[model samples]
Target: MNRRLSFSLILAAALSACARQPQLDDPVARGQRDFQGLGCIKCHQIGGEGHAWGPDLTLVGFRKQPAWLDLWLKNPHAWNAKTIMPNFNLRDDTRADLVAYLSAQKGQAWTVYPWRTAQAKALPSVERGKLIFNMAGCVACHGQDGFGGYPNNNVVGGLIPSLTNVSDGYGRADLHAKIQYGQISSPADPSKPKPLIYMPKWGDQLKPDEIDAVGDYLFSLKPKPAPGSAAASDDF
Candidate 1:
């Protein structure tokens, strides 16, 4: 009877240990989660999973100083007026975690900027356009794959509008104007009054052809005739 009781107790303890939730005590894990939760992946890639809109951050730590990254992440506009990156308004703890995570990213090669090199072809390819869409920081505002509301406008206080199928919403000319010349007012409904947030112009950052390529990619994000046939969208 004693042996049976001891065996039963051991079994119960083993089961309890197996059922317990995994601890999230590790800072690196927390940082990675914060990186994703804060919508960093919308613009930057780690391990090639995220969009290419921003610099490939796999090895950013190796290139930039930690102090600089912290300051830049805090407020990019302070450094550059033409920067496309948005202020995340991160909590101290959250910012620390994100910094910890980003600082740890290393060992990956940087991706080449397509426009920096001479173009050998007359027309841009969709594949190249897709790459430019991310590298150009369009994903910073528009979600990965231009889905929009990445961190969710509600989560971010309605500062951003959705881009799920922006081509359908805005005409080519209107979209072109908004992309080339930043707009403070709502492109969807100009009569609705301007919001505090707005889209920045890419005139300074992007070459005309680069803008055209990114524009093509955005237009291609239009919903397919068969929803089931479309690729799964990234909620990150």
Candidate 2:
């Protein structure tokens, strides 16, 4: 009887493993459907229509990894305590398909995070960026270290992320865009751009090198030790 039970369990385990793997018809489209059917489009616009309650996903594929997105879609609250995005426990098959779809629309990953060579040496600066943070009056709202301060005057949006740990949300390219534009993916309606409290279009104000310098600096600011978390600071 024990042997029969063990055999049954082994078969079940084998079947589960097989189920996890896709037959591989580019599961991305299936995932895209899941993205839509699951009602993500209601707030976060994807191929247009849904518009932009969230960042434009037009080029999201260029930004995140499949495995990362898959995990995120499954559970966002687990990662960031403040994200307004909802977690959709999408089936594994649909999730794989979504990753594939996004990948298809993705921009050049290396351009944003060139991991090799001479140009690659141009990593953003955390030290110099601190000075820029205060000088630019980013401290008025985002607070020192760019951690995003308390919303004193109806200014702080409840769902906004705390910069105390921002490096995790965006890629190097995403950082570049924020520092250059002060907004995420140019707003659909320029007349009503309020990504974060009346962010003035600084694209024209900052110069080529300063933009690079400031952006690199902003991207470089690593969070000190988060409030009371006893874990040793993450090295990277």
Candidate 3:
């Protein structure tokens, strides 16, 4: 009887240990569990869930490169000192797992994202363009209304160019082409790594009409000079 009781106790202890171990068979699954367990939901939203305090991550996979995302997760402050996101001091493996999970969020899980909703579609072209700009994650790098002060490593000026004066340089057709094909920002110093924040091509992703609407919205932001002013005369 004494031997039997000792054996039973040992078995129970083994089972308890097994229960304590996290099932990490799948990295994406583990990452998802960590995403929820680590309170990321408190600040970031995914697929219409969680708080809106941070940028919606539904289309992050499409908008950002995996390497950039990994670096950002490791230390957000290193990239943006003013960013409100806190450092979790996550381990390398944990960060990789999280990246895997986040990279899987390509906006297909939901039937329709907020930007493609009926209400959004009903808005005027310029208004709808504004909505697409924000919801499609252009605002992540360009800032609101293309104010554009975001940093890009190895890029000229050390910041993304603002679109407030795009009209000065680009015609409607030219702007549309730029948006469709996108462009790689060359490094200021050839010796350094390429800029991680180059624009992504939207031709395959956005419709032709949507592209035109974005151009309209951008042109509308052109700084209007005072009537009959010197700046106004330069428009000719």
Candidate 4:
């Protein structure tokens, strides 16, 4: 019944939804129908209804790593046999299209997601936003000041970089997009083919406004003076 994977996935990846446009491949429909034929609908639900033996697939693409999805599809049993879901040894050709189909969906339209350009301006009040950070168990990981925290927690974990430094890394839009979706990978782990770790999708867990506030809070973490500067100007 142990469903853990044997040869570690050793997977790693980047982030993108292709701002140009998403192409609709005929293979996706094939994957969808096959998904139904395989009786995946019996235990798992996508946009349609199905028994709830598994977590809702409403936003799975944003939750899991793509490589993980590919591996999970090939052998869920290898990772967790106790899983009620059966393992389907699918062909690589077929699995590719199947993944494309499933990964290309947004749970529901008009959810006031973080990616919308118009809504980006409604950032939260920094005061209330600070406490939300603490309440959401964020301080536990990103640290009390959103600087950084333990990532692996297993063997020696990875170093989580400080949020205070992200503004220098990407744009406001890029930051929001990354936050809503998730990070891909970094220079530290380049050889692997899929994303290393994933951040849970908060598109649902957070209200649109809360998303804005957290966005504001994150966008605002500036560096403090080096230990001893009592008379610094707010603008300087």
Tell me how far the alpha carbon of residue 174 in candidate 2 is from the true structure, in angstroms, after superposition.
17
Considering only N, C-alpha and C atoms within 3 Å, which residue pairs clash in candidate 1?
A: 52-134, 52-135, 53-134, 53-135
Candidate 4, superposed: residue stretches over 4 Å from native: 1-25, 80-82, 109-195, 200-206, 209-236
Q: Root-mean-square deviation of each candidate, in angstroms?
A: 16.3, 19.1, 6.7, 16.9
lDDT of 1 by residue, 49-116 (tens): 78867766765554344665676778777754567899987777777777777777653333544444
Backbone clash numbers for all candidates listed? 4, 7, 0, 9
**Cα lDDT, model 3, residue 176:** 96
Instruction: Compute each candidate's TM-score over C-alphas.
Output: 0.44, 0.38, 0.83, 0.43
Give model 4's TM-score versus the native structure.
0.43
Query: What is the alpha-carbon lDDT of model 3 when measured against the actual structure?
Result: 0.86
Q: Arrange candidates by lDDT, descending.
A: 3, 1, 4, 2
lDDT of each: 0.64, 0.55, 0.86, 0.58
lDDT of 3 by residue, 81-144 (tens): 8788999999999999999889888877567866578887788889988877877778889988
187-231 per-residue lDDT for model 4 (tens digits): 344544333344665655566556556667776797756645664
Top candidate when judged by lDDT against the true structure? 3
What TM-score would candidate 3 get against the native? 0.83
